[model samples]
Target: MKGPCTPCTTPAALTRIGCLCAMSCALACVCAPLRAQTSTFNGAVALSSQLVDRGLAITPATPILQAAASWTSASGWSAGVSGALQTRDPGHLSEGLAQVSRAWSLSSAWQMQADLLYYDYPGNERARLFDRTEAGIDWIYRDVLTVGLSATSMTHGADHQPRGAADVDFHWPLAGHFSLALGAGVAQYLVSPYDSYGYVHRPPPGVYGYGHAGLFWSHGAWRIELDRIATDPAVTRHGGNLVAQPWVGTVSWSF
Candidate 1:
């Protein structure tokens, strides 16, 4: 009869609609965690000291304060803004910086990351505005070791010439949520007449080489870092300033 046929088709239609709804709900549940894991916010502060020696005179030690806020995504995307103030007795300079990075997972034991940074330096005597751009890559091996390489270019407001630099770093993890990093690099100032107190008139084709070592520890909500930096052939040419070096200690809380 026509009546029987109508009833039979209605039940089958209802069943199909219910199945589609269930499948949609299942997919949403599976994706919710991945979306939630991708975004994070963090803040930190640090203090550092630097010893500068010019071939002619050695100036008093310098202290620097740095603060930053960053956001990172679970899929390896990150962005951050930072500011720094450096003071030596009565003289000081301030800088603002921004950076972005992306990370790719290559395998269970290996990963790669790339980043770019921009900086603005104010109160510079030689150039009121200086622009610096950098690109770098990091490789992770065995969840304990990482190596990185980076290149940077710096431009002054007045000069057409741009400075170039290269950097390399190695990092290893230690016990108690601690890690150690070592770095070495070279930077060349292309313009000889550039006049920042940090890079005042001295030599054409100015070259500086540096080494850095640091330790980082994390416990509960607290993170701490201790770092040392040393440069050869002193960037400046004052007496008793044969070596230019800086040491840093930082502490931060994670939310």
Candidate 2:
């Protein structure tokens, strides 16, 4: 038998770590605002499907429900909580996640945010329970461009993995009533002692990256996005390949 696969320690991992460090320094240089001002409650439903590997596929034809509420004080400080229930196929796999976030305006053009996410995956051999924490800062320039850097660390039972990401987004107004947002990002996952897929067999540490660009059209209370996303080979081996295509559609409604 071939020697157990070695864990990944790729150049991409180093680059991601460097980006996270840079974001931290940038966030520290600005003074955070002291108050919050606005709040909102929102809900949405969506359906998704994807093909995994060459032979496995899942069609989440049923709708998934999600809801969230947020409050921002007068000083630009904010806090929010959200939850979702998603099901793809009966007797196969289902997941639910709850998350909370806090954000502060560091300046007129810079903001910092932190979040904790708890996820439950039921009836899946890959993962049953997971929890993660993420922190990041966003820089908004010219009222149209936003750049962000975030770091995420997840724990499943005793396994631990950390990931880092950098993203840039641009917003464009359409017809004065609609808006479009386009962005792309890259993510790198740090290897750990645990197997890549929950099995005892060790798998090589892989670099996973993705790019996304989307268009959102808003009309009254309804919003729709035509999105395209693509992931690297590392993610393909990590069970996210089912919907790995570069295209997907998402819709939302507000009341």
Top TM-score model: 1
- lDDT tens digits, residues 1-255, model 2? 000000111111112110111111112112222331234333333333321111111223343333333333444444434333344435443443343445555666655544444444454433333334555555555335666666666655454556677766665778856666565556554332143334224453544455545565666645555555555554455444133455545454433
**Model 1 ranges off by over 4 Å:** 1-36, 50-62, 86-93, 123-130, 142-144, 158-164, 175-178, 190-194, 198-206, 234-243
lDDT to native, each model:
0.43, 0.39
Residue 228's lDDT within candidate 2 is: 51
lDDT of 1 by residue, 1-255 (tens): 000000001111101110111111111121222354657665555444432111111123345554556666666666666555555533444555566766666776766666676655564332233456656565655434445555556654544454555555454769989977565656554323334343443443466665556686766556566656555544434212233335544454433
* TM-score of every prediction relative to native: 0.63, 0.62
Model 2 compared with the native: what TM-score? 0.62
- For model 2, the local distance difference test gives 0.39
